[model samples]
Target: MSFVAIDFETASGYHPCSVGIVTVENGQIVDEFVTLIQPPNNSYNPHTIQVHGIHPRDTQYAKDFGEVFPEIQKRLQNQIVVAHNENFDRNVLIKSMALHGLHYEDLNIPNRWECTLKIYRSKGFKPAKLSDCCRVMNIALNHHEALSDARACAYLYLLR
Candidate 1:
């Protein structure tokens, strides 16, 4: 019943432009952390921008991954992590950390985070995308915004 639910919105190629973390303890949400990140070279892919609506200018003044690593590490280290799509979010964390010369192993978290998508799918939820699952469960969602997505994912995990 205790875990951190995470969501990442990428600028390009697994480079996180924004991250959201919601910490739950004793089945209650205790903390919510969210920040926009300036991706490498402040670059963004047009297609990704279309999905997340985060333009280059939005994060131009934000901290890069290395600058934000301490905050992320403190929240995630040795914690059970959950995500809507575990693979994508985990890969984003891994690749982003690698880009900043940080090691993912240092977090001491699990190799595979809890996945709401898989859980819902196995429970017979059709079209188990975050938005679809949210709709079925009446969980409010703002789609690709990282914090909203994380919050929704957290609620879905709680319900599951």
Candidate 2:
């Protein structure tokens, strides 16, 4: 089965202002996609930015959500898309995309999902935070950056 491990960094709790999807097909990362978006609402909280180091000014290089949707759909097409916290990430994705007139059901890609955090917790692991999971499993991390976090999640998903 193919699985695309996806991760996102929001300007805030709003839909993903940025996202990274690591496409793993045949047990390898064959492709990946990252996109930055201008949020309809300035969900950029100073506290979160301290954790993520992104601000509206820094997002000048990103496309607005509407512009990147097509590319996102194209890349994620026909794969099992999974994440550390699949529900949370998918919820953010659904809501954020909704703001731009896209709906979750419309994203027909990635027909299956495996939430690594759920599997880890089910195994009696104490924490589900990606960094914490890394610590427990001895996977080093560069926290909060979408690509690096996505990379780490992909590795952790494989370990499971």
Candidate 3:
């Protein structure tokens, strides 16, 4: 089966500032994409930067979420989207889209998406934190970076 693993690092609240996608086909990674996004109002919180290390300057000239939504939609629409934490990433996508005047219902996204953290927990793993799961499973992880986190989630899903 083929699927896409996704992750987003937000600038503040639920505003996605960066996105990462890893496409897997027949158990092999087929493609990957990552980009910094200029969020609505170009706003960001200091704490958010501490988590993901993305600064406003980094996305100053980057495309806004509206401009990047088409590419994101193309990758995720009608596909199984896997993320470490579906709630956060999914909400980020929804909120960011709304901020750009796009409606989540209009995106044609799958109603059910996969969460690696949930999968790990279901397998009796107590610590489902992405880095912890990666360590236990011997998967390399770069923690907070969106693309690295997405690739790690893909690897964990592949192992499962």
Question: How far in Å is the alpha carbon of 38 misplaced in model 2?
Answer: 1.4
TM-score of each predicted structure versus truth: 0.98, 0.89, 0.95
Scored against the true structure, residue 143 in model 2 reaches a CA lDDT of 88
In model 3, the Cα lDDT at residue 51 comes to 94
lDDT of 1 by residue, 52-124 (tens): 9999999999999999989889999999999999999999999888988899999999999999999999999
RMSD vs true structure, all candidates: 0.7, 2.0, 1.2
Error of 3 at 8 (Å): 0.2
Superposition error at 4 for model 3 (Å): 0.7
Off by over 4 Å in 3: none
- Candidate 2 lDDT over 52-112, as tens digits, reads 7878887766777788888778766665777888877777777777887787777675434
Whole-model lDDT values for every prediction: 0.94, 0.77, 0.90
Q: Write the per-residue lDDT of candidate 3 for residues 32-125, one digit (tens) a residue.
A: 9999999777899999999989999999999999899999988887788899999889988888877778888776767658999999999998
Maximum-TM-score candidate: 1
Candidate 1 positional error at 16, Å: 0.6
Residue ranges of candidate 1 with Cα displaced over 4 Å = none
lDDT of 3: 0.90
Ranking by lDDT: 1, 3, 2
Clashes, model 2:
1
